[model samples]
Target: MESQPILATGRLLLRPFTLADAPEVQRLAGDYAVSATTLLPYPYPDGLAEVWIASLREGAERGDAAAFAVTLARGGDLIGGVRLQIDAEHSRGELGFWIAQACWGRGYATEAVGAVIGYGFSALGLHRVHAIHFSRNPASGRVMEKCGMVHEGRLRQHVRKWGVYEDVDLWGIVSPIRAEIPHPLRSMPV
Candidate 1:
């Protein structure tokens, strides 16, 4: 197990969430507009952010997950988050991210996602990484595409958001380390 390293992009810093960020995380993620499209609940229960941030430490210790607080590089304001729920047994990880509604369209999500994907491959030894977005949120899908992920498929009614079922679009990218070595999906016995 290793410490979660900070990931930086030109405009953003992807760092581990500190309890100090709990207030800003609550303010931004609590917004209905931000929670509507993602799984985060509206009203964003009090103290949950702190609890969640604390749990991330335990998860990281187990190699089960890595979560980063997305912030501005210049001003250092916390704006959002990006995380990987790692499946160590399969050598893969599931990515998830969100930016405050006010911060939408700034490319922060795309930048942070690219950095985390790199960390997953280079640091975590992941063979592949994947993400899922509610189909209605094409903007998020676009972010995934901008990061070089391929749209794998759509899972209809795969998730219930705010009580209504929604379709989820699946996207994935293989580690460049693995991509360089060409291989078949199957091996035939001759």
Candidate 2:
């Protein structure tokens, strides 16, 4: 991978998923707000979290496209997660992210995700990077904007969530390696 084994920011460290972080993964994934936007089952159990984390680690080893956890370098605690998954042909990858509600005010997701995108462009040698969010969640749209993705379009009633058909917000950032927008999204101070 062109991206180094790991990436770090002043307050964050983006590294591959590992089974050892299962407990923190449980705490964050188990949160309702995080799960609500993320499509993670609301009552995500500790065991499920363990399995999910284990699977992510395994997937990376198998050459599956995936992401690393966003953790505080100081405490080494999982504050969030960012994933970049490539489709089978390896042409493009999707960017996914989630931050614990408790960490929302801190701009952590923006920084971590941006760093990961840089990794993908430089190291992963990927071309297209995009993200989709349930329409009910506009914060995700903002995150995409913060990351430098242009407004592409909206898919009306594209998915079913909690038993009702729902819409989706689709935004994409393509690094031709020389796009006018030189950087990924960055959170603007509110």
lDDT of 1 at 12: 90
Report, for all candidates in order, the number of backbone clashes.
0, 7
Encode model 2's per-residue lDDT on 106-182: one tens digit a residue: 87888888887777777766777888999888888887889888878989988776787888989988876745553
Instruction: Give the local distance difference test score of model 1.
Output: 0.92
Worst-scoring 10-residue span by lDDT in model 1: 181-190
Which ranges in model 2 have alpha carbons more than 4 Å from their true place?
1-4, 88-90, 178-190
Best by TM-score: 1
Model 1 agreement with the true structure over 1-190: per-residue lDDT tens digits = 7999989899998899999999998999899988888899889999999999999999999999999999999999998999999998989999989898888987889899999999999999999999999998899999999999999999999999878999999999999897776456556555
All-Cα superposition RMSD per candidate:
1.7, 8.0
lDDT of each: 0.92, 0.79
Could you tell me how far off, in angstroms, the CA of residue 105 lies in candidate 2 after the best superposition?
A: 2.2
Quote the positional error of residue 71 for candidate 2 in Å: 0.8
